[model samples]
Target: MAAPAAKQQGFYDCRDAWARTIEELAENDPRIVAVVNDSVGSSKLGGFQKKFPDRLVNVGIAEQNMVGVGAGLANGGRIPFVSAASCFLTGRALEQVKADIAYAGFNVKLVGQSSGVAYGELGPTHHSIEDFAWLRPLSNIKVVVPADSWETAEAVKWAAAYEGPVYIRLSRMPVPDLVVENRKFQPGKAETVRKGDDVTIIACGTMVHLAVQAAVELEAEGISARVLNMATISPLDEAAISAAASETGAIVTVEEANIHGGLGGAVAEHTSANLPVPIERMGFPGFVPTGSVEWLFDHFGLTATGIARSARKAIGRKRG
Candidate 1:
């Protein structure tokens, strides 16, 4: 497991990383095309548009049609990266996502921008807290939630090179870099961020950095907590989860979305079948009230302090 490095640099919005990666890939592969629902600025595709204006296809205000067009482009031998606000991208065009992309097995990279409560103030309608839950159950679709900018760039690269369907969740929220440079993105493998024995904390997306911080805090209290970055939610790293359950005796799962059918639920499903242990799932409990991302995290105990607290509670339960 990699130890958390000293706070490096300032916060960076992951969309920047996604944009840079897309442009780089486009430069190398002409087959790379971007399809968006009129979200050029929001998806951070202005530079890509400038470099390859002909490659950028904007299907204004029609998410369903936009996804359908992306699938069509894929059928025509072009690698279509469909980018849009996550809420509308997954919710409004779910049928198309299932039929045209996942079921049809098209090589389409679905980029859900501003995912989770990144658009917190935009109300629940805009909050993409259900994307993981929605996409996890589908077949032939890789569900990826990158932790930070570095992982975001790596994930985009993986999506481009790999064939078939993929959904890479990105955030507009700024976050410090978590994964180091040169670390390759391996699907269905959980990266161990911290190693310990008292308890294990498995987290995805925005919660990964917080889980690392929580493990750091747990170290001070003499409660060693193992932190696993479960970026791939669907084809979960069940081996790591089983190891954690057997070795640690307690596990705490975290995510930015609902606990039901999200990262937590995935972990629970695996552990229950293989190694049953005390598990506490942390996420938004119900309908999220409107507020800033910080407020929403606090409201639902999604912060590092909150994760550490859950870890302690899980540890106590194991002993009990």
Candidate 2:
């Protein structure tokens, strides 16, 4: 059996990548502005504020008003990147997102920093696990979760130029580089990380690397598992999901979100209609426990070992 996939030697924070990309994009496009809710530090936009003082609009802890300001900026022909904590950004400003941004088709880039359980120590109140569930149902809004720093930078660049509303979910947690530095990011495409036959593991954001590691572990136990990075949650890679169902025979989905309405739910919706297959979804099952991020992930079965376990169970269901 092959050994586990080689782990990356260093770590990188996606927020740093987002900040750098935003600054670079601002250099080229004068229309790029950042709207924040008194979260300049948390969003890692200090440098941006210094460089583009007038461009950084801090709305002073008003999440809903921040979204309104962003929409207004868009109305004035400026591209606004609304950056703030995921919980407040999505939960407090959801109506603005739905009506002003999505319904109006404003070209606003909603940047949810420190998403998922990246704030695990702060408990469920700080967790943005429900953002995906909340945003995916809205029309005219593209939901994206970048797996690592490279993907985060690329996604931010893409969102800057895209002509419609986009929500980019990012984490403060450090993750190994996933995509190549210069690989062009496609909004609705899924990247195949590893190929196998017995089962398929579809994951997004931070779960992508873990899914790849899980495939390696399953290989050691004589299970062939295909791993796919389903980065774009809203415009899901339907063709890829369909092919995985037809070829792999079984499917397991991993996410750092609720199982009901995130990556797992999206995959289930696709496969159920296009091609029925045995499936297992792994994510936070309920209100999460209070602990460090690492502890919470292990506690909720969001680790590589746990993913492999789910993959094996999915294979068993396929055989049964």
Candidate 3:
């Protein structure tokens, strides 16, 4: 048997980073403001409201109009960060996101908080599994799922400074930090967390931690896996995907969204014609199950066991 894999230091929630970015950015640029649908507390914006009370616009329980209003704010030369639960922001105002923010090319940044199964006991209505499929089709909108607090802060800062529509996802679940404080946010670049040759593991958001764990477990099996924390889905790191496929010969893609059009689909889309290789996509299969978040993750094969199994399958599928 192979030796046990190494461990990281500690975990942190990206939501705190979101709040920090909001406060710091708003301090610098007066145009940087927040617009929530009565989600100041839920989205962890209470501190933000306290810090910049006049900069926040809370529209209670209205998602569609909330997005439109955000667009209007952007059109009026203000940087509006629309914060809300992902299930409501993406599902409720998907069309408005497409037309108002993306199609119109506004400078609105959509912050999807408590994404995936973060609201464990809140049921399926609170789950955000369709955001990938919903936003991936639209052009001009960058899709970002920061893996840790550092990445979250950097992505938000980058999105705010850069002009255009961007979707930045913030998770409430505790996650170990990945990049350093000096890590720069490149629009479509992939961050390599672990290097290997047997197989490559590509993941975004909370799935990134699982991929790191899977790398450790695979190391015990004498299997090497290259782990890439792919935070951007819309503008994929094609070079990294191609390199992973070419160097490792196999790839396993993971995400919290559905397997249909999320990071997995983006990887498959790139590898299809550029550098074809054995690929396995792991994520929600679109079936809302009745169980705890941990149970739901296990149900969808998102655990470390599931990720290792999928990595093994991908390695096995590699053509000699």
Residue range 1-320, candidate 2, lDDT tens digits: 11212334677788999999999999999999999999999999999999999999999999999999999999999999999998999999999999989998898999998888887667888888998889989968999999988889999999998899999999877788764334567889988888889999999998999888898898988988998888899988899999999999999999989998888999999899889999999998767977787888898888999999888888888755
Q: Report lDDT (CA) for all predictions.
A: 0.89, 0.89, 0.87
lDDT measured at residue 63 in model 3 versus the true structure, 0 to 100:
99
Lowest lDDT 10-mer window, candidate 2? 1-10
Error of 3 at 209 (Å): 1.5
Per-candidate alpha-carbon RMSD to the true structure: 4.3, 4.4, 4.8
Q: How accurate is candidate 2 locally (lDDT)?
A: 0.89
Lowest lDDT sum, 10 consecutive residues, model 1, at 1-10
User: What is the number of backbone collisions in each predicted candidate, taken in the order shown?
Assistant: 0, 0, 0
Q: By TM-score, is 1 or 3 better?
A: 1
TM-score per candidate: 0.95, 0.95, 0.94
